[model samples]
Target: MMTVPSKLQSVNLNLWYGAFWALKGVSMAIRPQAITAIIGPSGCGKSTLLRCFNRMNDLTRSVRTDGQVLLDGQDIYASGYELTRLRKRVGMVFQRPNPFPLNVFDNVAYGPRVHGVRDRRTLERIVESSLKATALWEALQNRLDRPALALSAEQQQRLCISRLLAVEPEVLLMDEPCSALDPVATQHIEELMRELMQRYTIVIVTHNMQQAARISDETGFMLLGELVEFGTTKTIFTNPRDKRTEEYVTGRYG
Candidate 1:
């Protein structure tokens, strides 16, 4: 039988901000419907690599990169690539929850609305299904008309997830999604990630070792803009082949 490659893969990617390199030839595969965690200290290129998957660095005027990021076997950076379509298929969640000033219903419906889904019935269906998928439907069921910012911090983060879900993305990129959340809020997001993994490929950048250990199916460790190790999460956490990964995970040094 022929084995199919993963849905997302980075091949020998090198990124730089003008004269300074932020990631150097880092390569890894992200399986479909699985959570892949990128872990390391600050300025270690974990977040930088996450941004590469969706071409988020293009917004940075000084940024430049060489190599390929493949999505479903297609090179996203290739000439004639449709950035709008790419972004629609790959959604992003930032370290902090940033909802629009609109109400909860509008916030969750924004993506579909922008995509020309103007029918009230269809938008309602999308909003309900998306919020339900993120486990936020029960909490916000009665507050659909309330301002998104009126929710608690934890609710706000879940609302953020719901907002992303509304777009029906194929891959979800999370940059420390729980960093600004409390323990309870973080737990909610973790549970949401688990549910989300059944349908979306996920890549998360997290500094919290425990969070990575708990949620990731695969893990990659980076330092000084280079990938040092990539493997199953259990192996990366327990018996990493690279000394740098061992030290960073074991609390020896960041």
Candidate 2:
């Protein structure tokens, strides 16, 4: 059997927002080419832990952290770690589909352009491939010149994922990515996520237990500021060791 390598790891991670402790010694490993879902109630450190991967939590004022966030055996919080490079390597898709106010072509090309891919043909190919990877090329191929915001909500979300793919990111961090979409759109995004995991490591935070159960290989349940349990999706759902995890997974409490 082939062994899966760890793509990302968080060790004894603790975070504080002013006087509030947001994450408490949280530790887990995200495997390569797999979807790992973080599920918990609101304000339960789910999003906070997700942001720690690419250092998005640094944007928040009065936030302090102690502990290691490692990517491929390197500590991202180390002084020499480049923030821009970290973000580029570990791309993020937010709760809302936030496409730049640009045409579909430009939207997909944005990352490559920022990284200095100026040749027109190369940009075109990258745009097409990225869109194809996200399963959006057919629908938006002829409409490349149209404004991204003019597309349907699901299309916009897929476009955002395509934009991330254009950068050739190693990991994808999604924070409740389907929360803002209708049920049909949510299903579409979930399907897209499964496809994308063939190439990229995925970590998603979702409140929808059914969604997590459907899409994830591994599941982590966090509550208050602690990671209560982490295991295979089947095991976590069927036989959570922690009572808190059991309560949350069984819909007994959150």
Candidate 3:
């Protein structure tokens, strides 16, 4: 059998905000074109680790990092690595829908525009295809001129994802992407994620273990900045090698 290469990886990755350590020696492989869910209680460094993949943590003040975060086996933190290109290849969606305060067409066109795509027809195609990919085109194609903020919460979230898709990212880093929506909306978003994993590598940090079990192909359990176990979702939840992972998955403790 041939082993699939990791889309992204962290080796001995550590992070600190001022004097507080947020992630400690976390190392794991994220498979391509699949969903990898990181689950733990609040403040377990799951979000921090997700941000490291696209170097989003660098925006925070008083932050320090060590070790390697690799994309396609190349260290993303290497000196002179182009962050713009890195972010283009690895996009992010936040806990809340954060569409730009712009019309739907422009919101989806934002990334391509920033990357120097100025042709009107090209932008139109990108917007249409991106929205279609996120399952929003059918509903919003006629409302391309409408303000993104006026859409329903789920629509806004899907639009945010469309915005990322417009950039043609290879890996998507989602930090609680469904926490802001109702259960029905969350289900829709989960289904969208399942569809997206067919073409993009998805790494999601979720507080809901059930969500993780439902969508992720691989799951990693983090605890207070440490990864206690990482494996197939079935093994991690049903037959976890670590007692802590079993306990957490069983609702014994967060």
Candidate that would win on TM-score: 3
Q: Give TM per candidate.
A: 0.97, 0.97, 0.99
Q: Which candidate gets the maximum lDDT versus the true structure?
A: 3
Q: Give the whole-model CA lDDT for all candidates, comma-separated.
A: 0.92, 0.94, 0.96
Q: Ranking under lDDT, best-scoring first? A: 3, 2, 1
Error of 1 at 167 (Å): 1.2
For residues 1-254, write the lDDT of model 2, one tens digit per residue.
Answer: 12576899999999999999999999999899999999999999999999999999899999999999999999999998999899999999999999999999999999999988999999999999999998999888899999999998889999999999999999999999999899999998998999889989999999999999999999999999899999999999998899888888889976
lDDT of 3: 0.96
Model 2 quality (TM-score): 0.97
- Clashing residue pairs in all predictions, respectively, total 0, 0, 0
Residue 11 C-alpha lDDT in model 1: 96
Summarize candidate 1's per-residue lDDT along 28-63 as a digit string, tens digits: 988898999999999999998999999999999999
